[model samples]
Target: MNGHALELGGIEKRFGKQTILKGIDIEARPGEFIALVGPSGCGKSTLLRIVAGLESPDAGRIRSGDRELGELPAAKRDVAMVFQSYALYPHLTAAQNIAVPLVMRRLSGWQRLPLIGRWLTPRATRDEIHARVRQVAEQLEIAHLLDRKPAKMSGGQRQRVALARAMVRDPRVFLMDEPLSNLDANLRVHTRSEIVALQRRTGVTTLYVTHDQAEALSMADRVAVMIQGCLLQLDTPQRIYQDPRHLEVARFIGTPRINQLDARVDDEGVAWVDGTALARCAEPPRDRKVVLAIRPPALHLVAEHHPRGLTAWVKRCEYLGTECLLHLELESDATPLIASLTPELGTAYRPDQRVWVAAEPSQTLIFARSGERLTAAEPRLERSANQPEKLDV
Candidate 1:
């Protein structure tokens, strides 16, 4: 690893009366890739700017290793930032752009003049900077385009130039703000893997900000889900998606989005949705309103009138090659839900078809009305000596 651990504590920011960031805290271990993800205006970008020294926090401490970064100017922060715009100088060639940081940091005032600069600068310093530029450009596969200016390059090429520029500095931290958002869909996917590989090879601590959950989940070692100025959960990508600690995190993370149904947990700790029993709470709370979050893939269609399923009417059926998506509405409450099924399993289902929707007990997530996830367990099915099976709903 070639970087230092970056830490933020009690980070707060505001503009006039509107608070942009709440008491935010995050720590990125050396060489770790952390993605900051949220909807627009969620303070993700503000936090990144704070760390880069472009925007100062109203109250907080920013540190890398044992050094405090709060008071340092942006130029002195020893961090490289790749902006969404690619921010390449239109007038400069790719090689010059990649060497800008070294030129500024290594050459003196008189040594940087265009015409006389070459003569004033020592050959060794110039050669060293040139060699570094070539090395990084080659590493990024942009060596062939070194003499081309930004205006003549494609979006992906310019993006590579920007990345090479950042990597050439060998900064203690890398701050990237939606750097791949401008690329085409296929290119975005390809570039994502490249960036991940590059980060691993260089071992630079990175904080990437993106609104695309797919990008965040696929590329980051850890994901920080921020919402309405608060960082709700920070954990491994799998844990963030599968074991979200908060309801908002659950709702914001999945594709086709997680289905949320209105329900209430009875005094028996069993949650009920429209008269059908759902999951049970690990520790029962008094009768209270709760929400059940189930992913599309967690839901399955059963035969109509099945005892263990909720009655639903399919509103629409989308056939997507290998899989199918059935959009359904509960018969009792008309709550909207989606279920994922294999093509063979869903081919017979049509719009307006009546079916039963059932979720795996272990896959159902229960959350309080206040947006906190409640510990979930399987609801017990009781059968006394002479009585038939009955659910503790």
Candidate 2:
């Protein structure tokens, strides 16, 4: 089934005197998967709760398609949430758990009582509910576990049961809050693909919340980065990584973290680091200090005396099967630097080995001290190879 467009406008939430989410706005296109990701206590979960109606926004509006959902209770909103804890009833079998939503929505109170309720419920209604539960269980590949209680099922099985329960209702919007956080690493990876596939097959509008960057980057059509109760950036994964709008967004999105180095812009807008010219700012801020952010992959190791490289000493090496990380310290100011390399290249370096680190000019980002991203002219070396060259503005 096609899903409804979900919109959250100027969402704000607070816990007593502390604000948890500041004026957050997101418009998720119908059938799109959006991931809300950030470090712990960044209000990712709180925003999801607001959309699910578990929590009320201190100020904001939530809508599905053309309908205003702010006044609707959780159950009547036609939205389904699979929580971090799975929230399955311990005493209920998988089938029963998956059938709960349908039963509550379709059966009268008198027809919900144990033995007497079954007699009061029509055979057709009972058959419909049972059929729907089995259909959802099969879709999630958990039909075999339908007879077992939650305690007897593995974490993955229970997670599927939770998913089936949510999907059985055919919700217009689906919310998942770290649904695979409890699984083992391998299973978490495997289940991530499963969830993405399921969402695609059902064409549901999904909002997934997690602190895991990998999950957010790989599973979402677009990712929303939240920080300190504020929405920092919301864009496609590629843009979020390569074209971040803020220093905080750049610092939070990458693995091993993006390298931030001290820099200064002169009267002519040339940015320099340790006396070496790096880039030219578009709007020259005379005598202003700034930060240069470069992803690890944009750095390379060179001969110690290479003119274009920054002198550094290798501190250690981490060999991650397919890639390696060289932890280093700048010889000029003892600043920390990291370089991602191929396994072979990483193994060639040793602790205390002196090397030079060079960055790709096109990949460097300039940011003001206040964490605002800055524009810069394309950088190129203009002087002799042995002398520092001023970046042309």
lDDT of 2: 0.89
The Cα local distance difference test for each model comes to 0.89, 0.89
TM-score of each: 0.95, 0.95
- Tens-digit per-residue lDDT, 1-393, candidate 2: 588999999999999999999999999999999999999999999999999999999999999999899999987899999989999999999999999999999999999999999899999999999998988888888999999999999998999999999899878899999999999999999999999999999999999999998899999999999999999999999999999999999999989899988886776676777657767678765448888899999998876655457888999999999999999998777889999999999999999988888887778889888888889876654433553443222
